[model samples]
Target: MSRYPVKSETCHEAVDLADTLLPGNAGVTRAVVLVTDTAQLDLWRALLTGEARTSAVPVVLRRHDRRSLRGWAQRAEVFTTDERLERLHALTGGWPLLVDRAHRLHVELGDPDEVLRRLADMLADRSAVRAFLEATGVYADPALAAGYRSVAAEFGGDQVDTEAVVTAIACEIGDEGEARWVFACLDALQVFDREEAQLRLEPLLQQCMALGV
Candidate 1:
């Protein structure tokens, strides 16, 4: 199990401290710190590759991709067949949280297709998933917002946020082409949707981006 740092401390700082202590005269060869957030991943990319000069190469960055997701599925023990395994991987696009949710849903529903359907339903109703979509900051763009106005209209002026409304439309629509288009919009907005299904958002970010918060 991964041990989290104190409330006031940052994960990067903890990683740096560990890296510093690992090298000296000890038998330990190297240490790796994994960061999952796209924003934080971008920050680390800039920090590690920035123009600043450093004599020693300290940190190495690696991303979790489709291959990694396959390994993760094996470890999760949720996918019994190759087809289901591939479907799960495709549906999640290697997003860890989505994969975890898919695994949980499979455990509960016991039907692979049903898991996907349930995930689609959860994208609209789950607060945590809604928050994840909001973190992508797609709603801030006027053009994108205008483009999704029809989908937003489906909500009938409900108090629900734009992210949730658009996602609900995507899940509820039957036309594959239109669903694909909606998924593309979500992708452009940086909204989190796994294979055009199962949108996710971080709650803290959702709160941060809330109106008048």
Candidate 2:
């Protein structure tokens, strides 16, 4: 697994790069910070199966808890009612980035209702999200892109893609793999639902994509 490009690097090269990346390996710094999808992480571990694992610690950042989200609001001094906070929680699912963004907007607008409404609209705009992902070539492969569109239809309730996209994904690996394919691009497939103590898809993938993706 390399970077976004398909032919950029291989397992061996990445392993060799650990010398300059891991803590205290070079003059540049003691450690390296890498952000990648679950598939890349899996590939890295698989590459190390027969070798000793790196000493560098791995921290997985995920959605925040509802309670902690309140703390974020408190720190930002963005005062709002419980009902409004609940609405924000529903839109963001306690995703840290979204939560922070909401707090910032609340501070600017000084209207909880408007802040929450905008957040909802922002999440639901999949067309914009799709354009960004496509421009980045995040789903470059035709097959993979099709699979992504297929997953988007199911995950975000998006009805934009042609049926052919779904058919292509199903033909490649049937229903199950479509979701796994999505994980290849996203860091986490679901957000932690604090109330339920279970993982749930981030409310409607921004509504555009809870994908945080």
TM-score of each: 0.41, 0.53
Clashing residue pairs in all predictions, respectively, total 6, 10
Largest TM-score belongs to which candidate? 2
Best by lDDT: 2
Model 2, 27-114: lDDT tens per residue? 6555455554434544434332323354444445666667777777777666456887778777777655667778789778988788
> How would you encode candidate 1's per-residue C-alpha lDDT over 24-91 as one tens digit per residue?
56675774555433333323333444422323343422223556766776787666577876666555
Give the runs in model 2 whose Cα sits over 4 Å from its true position: 1-7, 10-29, 36-53, 124-198, 206-213
What overall lDDT, based on C-alpha atoms, would model 1 receive against the true structure?
Answer: 0.49
Pairs with backbone N, CA or C atoms under 3 Å apart (clashes), candidate 2: 23-30, 24-30, 123-206, 123-207, 123-208, 124-207, 205-209, 205-210, 206-209, 206-210
Q: Distance from true position, residue 85, model 1, in Å? A: 3.2
